[model samples]
Structure formats: structure tokens, C-alpha cells
Target: MKVYISGLYSGTSPQPGIGLSRSLRIAYPDATLVGVEYSNRSSGIHWLGFDELWLQRPWEELDLPAYGQLITELLDGGALWISGTDLEALWLASVFPDGHANLLSPPAVGLSRITKPGVEAHKGLPLQIPPFVSTDHSDWDLHAFCRKHDWRVWLKGPYYEAVRTKSWDQFEAVRSALAKVWSTQRLFLQAHVSGYEESVMLAAYKGELLGCVSMRKRELTEDGKTWAGDVTEVPEAFAASLREIIRDINWSGGAELEMIKDPEGQRWLLEWNPRFPAWVHGATIAGCNLPAMLVEAATGIPAEKTTAQSEEFTRVVLEVPVRARYPLPPLPEPYAG
Candidate 1:
């Protein structure tokens, strides 16, 4: 069987594609693993392990119909897709509104309710989502928010990335940068809760929680992404919440629930990422290979009760030679010569 994994970029700010591919390779040794990337320059393309690599046009260049057509073409012959980026996963959910058997992603209807802002307003989930205000709100005040949170708040995009700002100046600079890069002024502010950062990686299928692993960040990068972490016991309350969330949304495929456990021992729900975390390979190394479990669920293989066996896992940078088969990004006209 052929499996396609997207979002293969790996850099200082990494994507999950390389890690997910690694996990899948370990589980399905003989399966044809295809690394699908939108940009030609995605470094992971040359990192090895894939049986085949495909480069497509960037997402910005594709409209809805074109995107749908591309997906249909890619899924020909019933290839299973595991998207490694939130944007692609979200769009894939929409493309398969009624749900396609081969697509491993959350349902489209549920996606709307789990966006960064939507999660804060969602009810019946037994978790405290930090209070936030959208920049688009008529009465939005960053200064007031900063003062309330002791000048320590997380400036977040509606869909991706969060910057912890301890002052208004920092907030303004990051906000400006995000606005320019994302081409939108809409963003949100979440109150910063001082605590230990943790994530619960789960594999679910149509409301059933298949397997899960809990991790506490032992190390973090400048952007707050997991660099190293330790396997921890999954809290019963957290598991119950995951069940409720999965049932409420009929969630399918892989998900990461980020939370901050404050000094008082209360877990504050940060956000629910629709796809697996970049550190997913860490979970695989720890013995709970979620990407493989997702494949098993989709392929009718009996589920395995996988758990983390290794206590901890850490990341290190690797430099590899790019194969000549992969195309490089085009240079500017003046530099082309």
C-alpha cells in the first residue's frame, strides 16, 4: 500500500512531515512511503527514508477547485494521506466534507469549532481555555490585556503560531511581522499562564480514542516548539477530556492537545492542533508510534495498545547532502544568471 505524507519542510521552525515519515517508516518497513511537499526547497525531501518524493505548487497559488482537483489526483489508487501541517489538514477536511475513507483527518464540521478562537468559546469540554480577545473586535485593547495578564501574554494567530510577549513593544513587533507575513491584521491575545508546558498526543478514529501518550517538555526552542521531552503518565482527567472532545467532534486521525499545567496543578488548555506535533517521532521512539497507529486504523489492521516505553527523547540537528534529483527553489530574475 502507498501512503502520502505532506508538509516536508525542516528548519529552525520545523514541520511534522520528516518526523511523521520517520515514524511511519519504522512501522511499515516495506510500504511505499511518499513524501509530498508543496515547495521544491523543502529540506526534508532529501533527508532519505521516502520511496518517492513529489513537489507540487505552493498552496497560495491554488484556488479551491484547483486544490480539490490536485487532491483527487493524488489520492488516485486509494493512497492514505496524513497531513503534517495544520493548513493543509484543514483544507483537506473541507475537501472531503462527507469524509473520505482514505483521508486521515478530522471532520470538516468539527474543524470550525476547534480553531484557536473557537476553542475558547466551545462549551462542554472540561478544560479551562485561557481568555482571549480578537484584534478584530471593536473594543479590543492590547494594553488592557497586557496589564491584566501582568504584561505577559501570548500573541497568537487565528490558526497558527504564538509569541509570548512580556511587553507591549514586543507584542507590537511580532504582531506587525505576523500581519505582514500572513497578510492579515486579524490575530488574538491569550493570557499567559506560568506553568510547565505539556502535550497529550492522541490517535482517535470516529470518536474512539485509540491510543495516547503524554509528554512534558524538557527542552524548548526559541519559538517554544518541543525540542526535548519526557514521557509522563496520562492524567485520567485529561483522558476523559480527550474522550469528550473526540466524541463531541467525531474526531478522526491524529491530534495534539497542548496544555499548561500551572504551579497550582491545574491544567489550562492551550490549543488543539488538528495534526500531529513535530515531536511525534519522539513518541514513536518512546514506543507509542501514533502515525503508524493511524495507518493501522485506516488499513483495517487490528489496533495495538501502544504506550511510551522510553522515558525521554531529545532532538538534534542533522546536516544531509541534497540529492540532485530534487529541484531547488527558483532564484530571482536578476540572480538567475
Candidate 2:
């Protein structure tokens, strides 16, 4: 069987898809791994080591008719798409929910029920959402918010890009740049509570929790990503909350609950990553092999034992090879999003 995996950027950089390709291939050695990217030169194009690579139109330039044809071809050829980037995941869920066979994921609209500003609006779920206000980032009023709450605040974009700013100037600069990066004019001005960051990564199907691995950050890169972390078997109560959240959403995909634990030792759910995060390989090494299990759940293989081995990791940057395919086509316009 074959599947298309988006976000194949080389893993050495602080980018998405770092661990995805490696982990997925390790889990399923027989399947054809097709890599999808907007540009043929994307580091992932060379380093993904996929069986095939397909260049795509820029997200903004993607004509609906053309994308539909591409999807039809993949489906006819028996390739199911499993998203790796937040953008692709959102697009698949929102734009083409029933277009192909999906193993794990909620419909795009259902995903928005929890991630969008109003968690209370999502019925049947009791979730503690962080206080946040949406802004267009045009008339940014950094001082007023800082005066009301402390100087700490998290500036985020619609789908990706999150930065914690400690000063008015820093807030303005970071917010301005990230807005363009994520291709959204709006931003989420969120209350930044002081706490240790933790993540609970899971694989589910039809709201059923197939497997889970929780981790507490041991160290972070200067850019504020999980650089090193240790796996911790989550308490049953917390695990129950995770299951309830998924069941309520009927979520059928890979997801992560990012949280912050305060000095009082209470955790606050920070944000929900719609797809697997960069550090997903940690789950496989931890004995869950989530990506593999994800494929299994999708393919109906008798599931492997989802064991929680005590695994810890130190994420390190490394180099990858770059090669060009024959009969190359002209590169697409650079993506501004």
C-alpha cells in the first residue's frame, strides 16, 4: 500500500517533518512512501528518501479543480494521504474530509471546534482553555494587555507560529513576522502562565484511544521547542481527560495536548496540535511506535502491543544528503505563507 506524507523538510533543522519520515519508514518498511511538497528543492525532497516525490502548487495558488484531479489520481492509484504538516492536516480535514480513505483524523470542521477560540462551544467536553483574544495584528496594543496581565504573553497565528514575548517591542516584532509566516493576518493574544511544558501524544480511531505517550520537557532550544525530554506514564485521571477530549470530538487521528504545569503543580492545556509534532519519533522509541500503530489502525492490521517503555531523548541536529532528480522542472514561485 502507499500513502502521501506532506511536510518532509529535512529533520536536522528546527522544522516540521524532522522525525516523521524516518519514524514512519521504520514502522512500515514495505509501503511506498510518497513525499509531497510545493517545491522540488525543499530539503525534504532529497532527504525524505521516499519512493516518489510530487511537487505542488503554492497553497494560495492551488486551483480547486487541479487539486481535485490530483487527489482523484492518488485515490485511483491506491495512495491514501496521511498529513504531516498542520496546514495539510487542516486542508484535508476541512477541504477534503471524505475524498479519500483516512485512518486517523477528525473532519476539519470538528477539529476547529476545540482549537478555535471557543472551547465551551464544543459540546460534551469539559476542557480548561487558556484565556485568549484574537487580533488582526494591525493595531497591536501591547502595553495595555501587559499592564492588565503581566508582561508575559503568547502571540500565535491561526494554524502555526507561537512565540512568548516578554517586552512590548519584542511582542510587536515577533508577532508581525510570524503573522506573515503562517499566512494569517490574525493572531491569538494569549495569557502566558509560568509553568513547565509537557505534552501528551496519542493515536486514536473513531474517538477510541489506541495508544498514548506523555512527556515532560527536560530542556528546550533557544527557539522554545522540545530539545530533550523524558517520557512519563501519565496518571489515570489525566489519561481519562485525554480520552474524553478525543471521544467528544470523535477525533480519528494523531494528536497532541500541549500543557503547562504551574508551581502549584496544576497543569493548563496550552494548545492542541492538530497533527503529530516534530518529536513524534520519541513515542516509537518509547515502545508505542505511534506512527506505525497509526498506519496499522488505518490498514486494519492486528495491532501491536502499545507498551510504555521508559524512553528519553536528546534531540540533536544532523546533516542529510541533497540530490536532484533527472528531467527537473522549473521551481514553483516561492511560498510566502
Candidate 3:
């Protein structure tokens, strides 16, 4: 099948798109692969061994019409389009609302449903949701909310994006920083949840779970603080419970479940990421290549059999690499020729 992979950039290496491309080449040696780069730097070309490569200016600068037209062109030619970047996926979901039919259903449904609130209101279910009070000001009550929750709560964006804080003063400081860029009224608050974090990455088709892997966080960082951690497979019972949850939600494509372990040793739902997780590279190394699985799901091919072995004691580190660029000294002022 013809597959198109888009969203390439110079700083995209920390993501698993390139690694996914390499894995796809190994798995489907004969299938045609197309790579599209969205930047002028063109660093992705060196890694994505594709049958064809297309480079365009970054998406932000492109006119909506041009961007839509380009996407249509690519879709018209390829049987499957794997968005190698989150922005591309969001763009597709917005511009070509029905275009995701080419993909499996779960992820598409999750994206469409969770992008906005009020569709489903919290009914006070026993789910581990942090108590939140909304205010007109994006920065309103952030400190009070944390204080009410005993100096710990999660600061959430309109969506599930979370920022954890330990004190009302710290929470207020975060709100101040965000207020510089975003209106405080746009910010919301949630009670902070304290527990071990675990994630389940899975592929589903027609509400049936096809493949899944559970991982515990080996490390976590927020606000410049980092903690070391490890990932292990979810026990069979927990996996089954999470699968049922996915099925109940009528989820269809690629998705993940974030959970926390309470002091009682029970798993509590943390949040659901309708798309790929940030640490997808870890899943790739653990024998589940999410991008390839997504491609297979899009094309109606069964996901490759994944070994159910956990790389226990396997330590992984997420590091930010910084590089300094030196500029050339300006040439001598023009000498009269």
C-alpha cells in the first residue's frame, strides 16, 4: 500500500517519527513510502528513506487554502497518510473532518470528542478527577483552588494538558507566566493527584483491542524538576479492565490510557490521550511501534504480533540536548570595487 508520512522538521528527532519510518522500512521492505518535510532546514531527508520526498515551508506560514490543497493532493495519491507530527494530525482533523475515515475509528473519535468540553459533563463519578472551579479570569482562583485542595492540584488547560503545582503561591506564579501569553480566563484548575503513573498504549479496531502495552513511568518532570522512574507491563487484570473501558467509550484507533496507583494499590484513571504519547519512543523500543501499528490499522492490516515481554529494569532517560550555533563574523565593509 502507498503510505504518506508528513510533518518533518529539524528539531523533530526527539519524537519517534524517524524511528517509525525506519521500522516501517524494515517491516514492509517493498511498500512505497513517501516523506514530506514541513521545514526549510530539511534535516529529516537524511533519515527518512522514502520512495519520494517533498519539502514545503512550515505550516504556520502557509495560507489555509494552500495547506488544504496540498493535503488533498497527498490524500488523493496515497492509500494511507500517517501524520508523523501532532500538528498535522490536528490540522487533518480540522480541515478534512471526514478524511480520517481512512484511519481506524478510536483515535479519530477521541480527537473529535475531547477537543471541546460540555459534550460530556462530569457526573461526579468516582473517577480520579481533580475538583475545579471555573472563573472568568484565566488566572482566577488558581491559588485558592490549590489552597482548598491542600496545596496540591493540577492546573489544566481547556483540554487535558496538565501542570502540577505544590503550593498556591507556586500555582499563582505559573498563572502569571501563562497570563503573559494567554488570557487567564482560558486556564482551568484541577486537584493534584499523587500516585504512581502508568500508561497503556494500544491499537484497537471496531472497538476490539488488537495490541496493548502497559508502562510505568521511570521518570517524570514538571517545572524543571525531574524524577527517575521505570516502566513495566500492566498486569493482565488491569489490562483487561482498561480494554473494557476503551470498548465502552467506543474507541477505535490509536489511543493511550494514563492511570495512577492509589495508596490502596488500585489503578485510577489519569487521563486519555486520543493520539500518540510523547514518550512513544519507549513503546517503540519495547516491541510496539505505534506509528507502524497505526499505519497497519489505517490500511486494515492486522497489527504485527507484539511480544508481551516487559523490559523490566530497563532504564530510559529523556534528555533535552542543546546545541550552540556560532555566527560568522560580518565580512569587511564593501571596499570600492
- Candidate 3: tens digits of C-alpha lDDT, residues 1-337: 7676664443423333454565566556677777767654545555536667666666767787877776677566655666656556655656665444454333444465543222231122233543565534444454556567886666655544466768667766766665553444566666655677777777665556666777777655543211333455656875676567566555555656666777776656655555555455456566666666666755766545544344643323334222122123347898798
lDDT by residue (tens digit), candidate 1, 1-337: 7888887888777888898878887777778888988877778989788889877788788576886876777666688888889888877887887567778888786687778865832465456788888877543476887788887778898777888888777888998988986689899888888899988888877767777889999999987878999976577876777678677777787888888889988878888888888888898878888888888888885434445568899998888877788766667678554
lDDT, candidates in the order shown? 0.80, 0.69, 0.56
What is every candidate's alpha-carbon RMSD to the true fold? 3.2, 4.8, 6.4
TM-score against native, each model: 0.88, 0.82, 0.69
Off by over 4 Å in 2: 11-18, 98-100, 116-127, 136-142, 169-186, 302-310, 326-337
Model 2's TM-score against the true structure = 0.82
Candidate 1 Cα lDDT to native: 0.80
Backbone atom clashes (below 3 Å) for every candidate: 0, 5, 13
Sort order, TM-score high to low = 1, 2, 3
The candidate that wins on lDDT is: 1
What TM-score quantifies how close candidate 1 is to the native fold? Answer: 0.88
- Winning model by TM-score: 1
